[model samples]
Target: MQIRLLDLLSRIKRLQEEREILRRNQALELLKTLKKEYEELVEERKKVSQVFTKSRFFKAVELQDLIRLRDSLLEWEKIAEKKLKDGYEELAKIEEELLERHKERRLFERLKEKEMWKQSEEELKRLYRELDELALLIQGQENKR
Candidate 1:
């Protein structure tokens, strides 16, 4: 039963893997998203910094606003890095589970083979016993004749 279930699970997983087209792609996609977000944040910061520069010659903008923007980007970058690391860790765990499933499937297959071999041996022994009995019956009848 486990063998069959494992086989089904593996097939489904393989299909999903094919659809995903390389598990590494997940990580790559994550990196791309993070890069895009970082770039957008940098652009936002640049715009704010530019405003501060322009204000110095014209209106007055607080330096605090620029400082706040830089701090927020730094915080977001740390969070993004953690998420990326977690994503990789999750991938590792999935691979480990797949490996464990393979091991279990192999073990079940070996057990099934052993059981079939035992059944075959018993069947062969029964046939030989039946043949021996027939030979003894014929010999007894010949003596009577």
Candidate 2:
């Protein structure tokens, strides 16, 4: 029964480690996606700026169109910036959660170790008592002889 319990505890520890790894991988993927989006936004803003500048050489109607495009790009840039900020906030929360999980798993592992040590100590004591009894029986036989 003790061996079975110990095996169960070992399995639980392994599962916890696997879960932590999965969560870490997901967080990394999210961060990568956010970074890619942020980079794209930056590129789009640069293109808009170039177009706005080149509008100076265009006719009145084309210049007006370019101005509208520039305004729209500015609004999109603001939205993208907010999304990026939110992504960072989510990443921070995930990191904190991972840290807490690690601590909890460590606590459980320590408990399991302590239990194993206690069981071993008890087994050693039992063996010593058996040996002492056998020694007494041998001494009694010798005295009788």
Tell me the whole-model lDDT of each prediction, alpha carbons only: 0.68, 0.76
**Which residue runs does candidate 1 get wrong by more than 4 Å?**
1-66
Q: CA lDDT of 19 in candidate 2?
A: 78
Q: Write the per-residue lDDT of candidate 1 for residues 1-145, one digit (tens) a residue.
A: 5545545655665555454445556666876787678677667767776776776653234466567777787788677777767877866766666566556556655666666677789999999999999999999999999
Please tell me which predicted candidate would have the highest TM-score against the true structure.
2
- Which window of ten consecutive residues has the lowest lDDT sum in model 2? 1-10
TM-score of 2: 0.80
Estimate the TM-score of every prediction.
0.57, 0.80
| 33-109 per-residue lDDT for model 2 (tens digits) | 87787778778878978886765578888878867887887787787778778777776876777676667667666
